[model samples]
Target: MSSQASLRPAVVLSLVLVVWALTGLTHAQPKASVLDFSASLGNLLPSLSRPANSSRIFYGVMFDAGSTGTRIHVYTFIQKDPEELPVLDNEMFHSIKPGLSAYADMPEMGGYTVRQLLKVAKKTVPRLEWKRTPLVLKATAGLRLLPSEKSQALLEQVQDVFDESPFFVPDDSVSIMNGTNEGILAWVTVNFLTGHLYAETRETVGILDLGGGSTQITFLPKSKKTIGSSPDDYIARIDMFNSTYELYTHRTCIKYLLCHVIHRPPYIIVLLYTPGLEWRVFKSSCLPKKFREEWSFGGLTYIVSGKPDGESYVGYKLCYQEVLKVVKDIVHQPYELKDTSVFYAFSYYFDRAVDAGLIDRTQGGMLEVRDFKKRAKEVCNKMSKYRPINPFLCMDMTYITCLLKDGFGFKENTVLQLTKKVNNVETSWALGATFNHFQNLKIHR
Candidate 1:
């Protein structure tokens, strides 16, 4: 099995090399004789001209830099139709021990460290036509939180390995933008799954993306009508849409708190898309310091509020005094809490004595039902009054769903999975990043 596995990579490598050789030969031939060569090259050459359809599919390296470690995805675009962008030959490279930080003291997570990652990629994709197909290095909250010097040092290290360097080495800002794009794409795909395409040409769309470290909510008003009828229709469609990604600390609330303690944030917020049930995590700077250890609903519960006498499925029993104390401590941090008037509203399936009458209907809105959009607008409008100085937002499923509904105004029919049933999503993060080989990728000038 070991020998066969080793041979498998070699065979694949050899095939890529042959394609490179053929590409070189084809380019060397005169432009006029290209038609004559087509007759000989046959159907294979047809795809060669367009890398999207070629045997040498366009490859992309996505490193979701988190506070603890970086999750890297190496995949290729193998979809034939633009409307259907799929991924192929996908593999994830993980470095769990050492975080994405460039500090020399940390333990090495993988054999190929961050510095070595670029070198390995350049070597692995030997004939990678960087000019035609550029490699994108996107950082999320990890890069954002990294000191300028450290981030630059990491980028320089990666840049050193490139022969024909990548066209774009975007900063955390760009990563945040891409993260937003991914969320919007997921929302659109969800809409597609529900058989609800755009109801109006100038339709309002909201996108909320929860990643390992950060969570972003993008809200767009009615815009002009545009159609993507080309081969790359799907990307065009996504491009036409606007996006905003909220950056938290890292992928998990635990990591977010850890990074937050040191004044760091994750690079971007990504919604982990899986085959079965979907799940999302909100960026909560308010996540208790206790979560720095392993996360548990109980730990999260104690931090947000004091100990509860009985279990109430949605968050802890409301102790206004206790919850207020915690919120005050968080408010004392460097960044000023913006809108003092905007109230912090806790949602519940059933009303408790402390929460029942306290929700200020005159000053703000209180939500009880599952109408997501209605609830979100109330929070956004109410929160706006507070003038929150920090970008970080704290929310549970009730708030998150509201944000996804009202902040982004996602179509009502968007598929939503119950929190209790989140485990139904069969594919784990490790599997999607490491072994999934059917994702569609693309490149544009």
Candidate 2:
């Protein structure tokens, strides 16, 4: 037989494998509109030649439009069989600075920014599979802080871009996620990636997500006091993978810790702008005695500094008092938090820990709550030296220390695992959101 004729059978076999892998079943139904020609070849194959589908691979692209930056997570997943959940094979991640919220005034520019990131996805997903890949963008506290009209404009612009792209876009492709869902999804991502979801013991770690405009604390309450004492809105029920989790979620203001505190409200601060007062400054004991600078957040700039006339004591004690005002009386202490429950801190939590040199940036380590207090004192007292490295380090550290002790009511010796990634996947809500999208689309089935 000729070489060309012999190669034809191998090509036919390869086509059959591709079809089986895409469809996931030997008895095919109507071809899904999302799949292209190659995925619909199952009907042409002879019944005797059909083989059981062993493994199938798919892709999902999720964009995390955060306060500080925009990140793209292109996830590759593999399924061993039709009845099983897809396993995360690998992730292609990239980021750009100054978040989408930065373009509130110029929304088209924000769309262009998203377009730039989509190039990464285009390069990562195969050309033949582009039409089937799902594209989604979920904005966090940064965009949530914007005026309703402004945020909607940004989302509309992003939707326009998604409409133009070759990838599959759902009806609710781009939107700002509420704080409660954000916390729950992060918890899901951590527990799922950590193998705690399928564990027989039902032990799961809590998540502390500190962001630019706000912060979230989510965990499964071991004690009845935590559930009974919490406000009705603070508890949320999440149904996933045939299990229901009654999670306790708390959304608090952390923006003042990052930017400037405008007014001394109870738990949250209402941001206001004065037209002609550039010299007006917000004072905080958490800052160095002589520190004065201009800081910005949520598209507004504020002058903030330490009190120049106060007593010459600037350390953890005073800084903790200043930070305490932001969290005390506002945050409820969960009964289980005082015990040995492990907590994973991320976002600004991980960043501040690394900035204070309490943990390594690459290989994160475990540290007790007292460790943050110790480091806060050192950073606050030695501000002259570390100021150039990060002017806000002292305030940030003090706030974190205060947030843990007085805010969330963690014990002094309570351990916190600081990490930015788990199993090479980002410790963010993006992964869980991607999984949710896949489930909603029924792509796995």
Give the top-scoring candidate (lDDT): 2
lDDT by residue for model 1 (1-445), tens? 0000011111111122233334443332211221232222222222434545333345445554544555444434333432232323333343343455534223232223554555444544445433333344444455566567666665554444332354222222123223333334334333322222334443332323343333433222222221122122222222211222221111123222432312222211211111131233322222222222222331342112211232221131221222232223121111111111111122121111122232343233333224443443333233333223312122232334433333323345543332110111111122222111111111121
User: Which prediction has the highest TM-score against the true structure?
Assistant: 2
- State the TM-score for model 2: 0.79
Model 2: weakest 10-residue lDDT segment is 1-10
Query: Model 2 Cα displacement at 118 (Å)?
Result: 1.7
lDDT of 1: 0.30
Which regions of candidate 1 fall more than 4 Å away from where they truly are?
Answer: 1-56, 79-97, 102-112, 115-133, 163-207, 211-214, 218-445
TM-score of each: 0.39, 0.79
lDDT of each: 0.30, 0.70
Q: lDDT (0-100) at residue 389 of candidate 2?
A: 84
**Cα miss at 313, model 1 (Å)?**
16
